[model samples]
Target: MQKIKSIFKTTGTKNGTYSVGLTVIVIAIVVVANLIFGQIPEKYKNIDVSSTKIYDITDTSKELLKNLDQKVTFTVLAEKAGADDRIKTFLSKYSSLSKNIKVEWIDPVLHPSALSEYDTSANTIVVACDDTGKSTTVSFSDIIVMDTSSYYYTGNATESEFDGEGQLTSAVNYVVSDSNKNIYRTTGHGEATLSSSVSELMTKNNYKVNELNLVMDTSIPEECDLLLMYAPSKDLTEDEKTAVEDYLAKGGKVMILLGETSSADLPNIASVMKEYGMETEDGYIADPSRCYQGNYYYIFPELSVSGDMAKGITSQMVLLTNAHGMNLVDPARDTITTSPFMTTSENAYAVTEEAQKQGAYTLGAVAEETISGDSAGKTDADTSENDGESDDAEQEEQKTGRLTVISAGSLIDSQITDTFTQLENTTLFMNAVSSNFDGVQNISIEAKSLGTEYNTVQHAGLFSLLVIFGIPLLILISGFTVWYRRRKA
Candidate 1:
């Protein structure tokens, strides 16, 4: 009986100990599992609800909002179905960040009245404001990609998934900023228009471009900040001359893009340049090695970068201008300092008329100066010019730069879009222009935007959120339930 009693007690103690040990083991396993897998919902049996990263405050939209000061409205003129998810997502992200940006959806089909007033198209955005009274339209193609390589819609029948959020953000930047500067480009006598790809790029970078026949209007508009003379085939009227002089006297900025006009022919303009610093030569600049498409056009020549205008943009760019030239001067005026913005390599030569007619010649150059006559940095009137008739070819001491001067009448050819990358040029040029100003703030000009660009992934076919979070969740639930049932039993 004693032995039996002892045996029974031993067995009871062992059973109790075994049960406690098993329960402890189960609890440990549950705790370890929770630590490894994280939380999961029940319905998503195969889903993994775990996330490796947390939501942060600083995103691309937020960074963009922080840079903007003016109130901007992004009016979406399409159905939600047509809207690019990336654009909407970016706008939504921007909306949550700052009160300065507001998004409104307008179905152009439903309201035909808006189409006329806003000139809006399908899947488009009209960025506008009541104060500036200026509005810019962005089409679906304007902000999105046409193809994966070399962006152009394949005969207007193809579209690519474009995360245009990044670029459109930059566009909104151009319109809303105070630097939407206007460079009134002279036309008539046949100058180029903003319709060209290069001009389009100029406009995109805070320049409100307009073809001006100052001869027609007599007065250069008060709103215009600068004037540009680009390959004008005709001479300016006396009134036009006075208009130009008056603008310069008022401390306005001017850029002359000259062509194959003779020295005597450009007397009025040459006289103005001579007052500042230099004069355009009678013959064309020629280089055999640098000639393009043949001898009439210059080819890859080493360009001179000696001024702010040239140095600012040439950080990483190779220019390819054709038949364009200029008469640049570095005047003694305290308000001006002209320098060679571009030049061909030393292996280059400025061929006179004899060589030009011989079917070989150098054809382009660039020139610019810091014209600070007043507090706002303006160009002074051509007050003192000798108009020297010095035809000395001994310009070995003459300093020129990458401010390209193309002798060819058409440096910016119609096929400019095919030959050059306008997007790249525009970005750097805009940066240069923004930096050129005396007192203004440009965010990109100052520094990089922010932390890592938070590009949101597409919400698509069941793999993204489901696989990442759903599957882990199911195992967690099943494990917990089995533990619970075993405990109950």
Candidate 2:
């Protein structure tokens, strides 16, 4: 009992019982703090500090989640034991974003009946709309996109990029949307086909794309949300042009990509722009200051911040190769409102006789016109044929239509051969398209390459020494100083 009392007695000038109690209290505080933190959601607990934000949810996803009215259930058909950590964390972010989004994990081996209605495999994700009884399935292969170009040449594929956010968001959009937006691409005039990347972007944004030949159909389909004419090699016929103008006059949207007219004449097609007092220049544009790699023909135009086309475009420079210049004949046309959103540098000039002219040239322009009067009753063909008969009241009650014209057709050409340059061009084109349509947000996410990087140390020996010896020595000194002070105390 005496020995026990001595063990528990205060030492020096300190109370041993108080010191023990304080230590116990400090440990208890740490334990309680960790317990509380552990109870928090993984999405809130883990910090995403990756350079590319590989696991972070995008603002586009957050916006969509915020506007969601119906309950969306994301069912993950995978085993919990071998689930992907990144995917699990990414889905958790959606759950925390809104009360309308619910996430669930089901082991396919145990609950096979839950996936009976869905065509899903072991690692698939099914996003279902409870109100509409609609669902979209995303396979595991869709999340990890591979560069398939290698398979065509060498029969091997390397993992290219992560598309989890795009695919998952698309699935969610698909389930919730009442109907997909329909885009009609004009064909039969040698119009260039959309590239694979652009097609993929449309799919990811929940757009249904179809081909329309005006010659065969004689009218734009009623379901067409937007009509795209990309690099038509031949001029549109009078009837086809009239059909297009009629469609536009009825509040339709059209995107026209004009090619260089030096080689080919598209008079009827060019006449479509005449209604808004905008026409394509005769020669190709060359920018000495902003051209790519000192090539004047590959001009990089400046984006206009004041225009709607460049509203959400983050990139300031757009690469346009073999582009023609545009001239606004009447900037103050009473019937139309024109905004030139893209222009070349002041030093930019034409490659032909117009090169000697002095001024910045327009490369992209948007025109909105109110159709009324005799013009309202007349198609483009009728207006071009008969120009002189209209009353004042007929012009008063008019409906508005929009036309977006870009001088460069190569902006959407996949044959450009430069991946980075192509991406920038595609971004600009998609931004313009998105701005023209209502309620259509740009959800195109570029896939990030997982290439390895090598860092070269300037002083390898110094770095090695610091890492091997300096850190440990500093820690040892700190420990010794603490111990020496404690002994003195």
Candidate 3:
């Protein structure tokens, strides 16, 4: 009986020893981890800093922060309600970019009168110089798009697709640099008025909006940084063409837009557009895939996108229209890269029908094309013209190369916007036009704030679902399995 009791006790002792050993191992691991990671900061606990990625910094934005001399302060006056992880994340990046870039998230809600320090709204940014701590304020919603074109897309202009190039760098330069923006809008030939919603967007950004009457004045204003040509009637006189060419030659930025009128309708203006490798057909575009199936007036469709200015805009377009449009095909060689930044469905095609019936394939349209007008310039003319068809007046038509040709009429005019919102295309076209000019870096950083859709990187709704829920559930399931196995063992 004594031997049996001793054996049982020894067996219990062995079990106890194994348990003690396992506990000791876990404790040792915890101690070592704490030592190596330096007792993880309280704020960063649970957030694996090892998994945090440092965005590849551009030389421009990099050199900016690196060479910064003063103790710079970032006063973010975001309303606490909409203040999000995105702003926080970017703030962290800004911190990483420069030690001088001090970021303070100010809550205007908590202390309503705190805005008096900067004498601005809560949505404004007060960027102070590191040297004297002197500051300048930019709006919280102030946007930037980096594409080199004169025009930048903001507020909800539509495009067919996306490009990953970090155009934000240019906007960063604009924000940090002392350079002021000079945005020019061209008027004549029944263009949309500047006081419209699109023009108001510029005003909100504190840009000086000037209406350019190149037809009347025959010269681009000296203070101009970007020139915009909204949908125009066939009215660019020869003097207007020469003035435009001269402005572009001197590296001045510009934007041009067209409506439904064709080369046939606006012979003088058509000559300019044709020079840019854009040719307008006589009619319109109609497609079941691109049009409202049951509704004859609703023309909702996906346009095409490419780097080609002739493509007009980008794949990021979402335009609403009652009638579709006409387009410009690159009538030039492959050296002219017509970036398919935007495109319609393959089922769509241009229609040559006139005075059409409801059932007939008919909608307004335009396909813009671009070509080299100079070593550093692009023109709209490349499509061949009928030699015998040239008239004395047609011979003097001003030619446009790297020019944006529009085949749609209603989309460009404001009166018809009642049925469609080419406002997206309008913004995009002007942006492209402003960008078409050579050498002037296009600033588009604020474009990131265009919406959460762009912020999501890729169909973010789906990716977010996976990250916010699926991944955590997977981990929980894995933990449960581990616990179950341990109990069984």
Q: Model 2, 1-489: lDDT tens per residue?
A: 998777766574258677888999999999999999989976688788765566777777777878989999988899967887766776776577888888888998898886675765788888899888889888766776677887998899876667777787888888887777888998888888888878988888788889998878868888888899988888888999889888887767898987655534888877888676677777788889898899889887988845435444665766779888878877345867887888998998877763555458888888887765346655699877544545554466555678888888988777662456424677678777777666676766555444444678997999999989999999999999999999999
lDDT, candidate 3, at 185 = 73
Go through the candidates in order and give the C-alpha RMSD of each one to the true structure.
Answer: 15.4, 6.8, 13.4
By TM-score, how accurate is candidate 2? 0.80
The positional error of residue 274 in candidate 2, measured at the CA in angstroms, is 2.1
**What is the Cα-based lDDT of residue 371 in candidate 3?**
27
> Clash totals for all models, in order?
50, 1, 86
Error of 1 at 213 (Å): 2.9
Give the Cα error of residue 111 in candidate 1, in Å: 12
| Backbone clashes (count) for model 2 | 1
TM-score of each: 0.54, 0.80, 0.49
Off by over 4 Å in 2: 9-26, 39-43, 148-156, 260-264, 305-308, 331-333, 353-356, 372-399, 415-418, 421-423, 454-489
User: After best superposition, candidate 2 residue 65: deviation in angstroms?
Assistant: 2.3
Task: Output the number of the lDDT-best candidate.
Answer: 2
Q: Candidate 3 lDDT, tens digit per residue, 1-489? A: 999778757978779878999999999999999897776442243342322122333343565567666566767787645764534554555556666666677888887777987788976656665555346665534422233332354544432212111322332343455545677777776776643534533533335677777767887877877676765655777788778756655445545545545446666565544444444445445555655555423344454434323232333444434333334455444433322233345565454554542232212222233322232333334223333444654434432234333334344445533233323555454445444444333232213223223233867898889999999999999999999999999
- The 0-to-1 C-alpha lDDT of every candidate, in the order given, reads 0.53, 0.77, 0.50
| Worst lDDT 10-window in candidate 2 | 305-314
Greater lDDT among 1 and 3 belongs to: 1
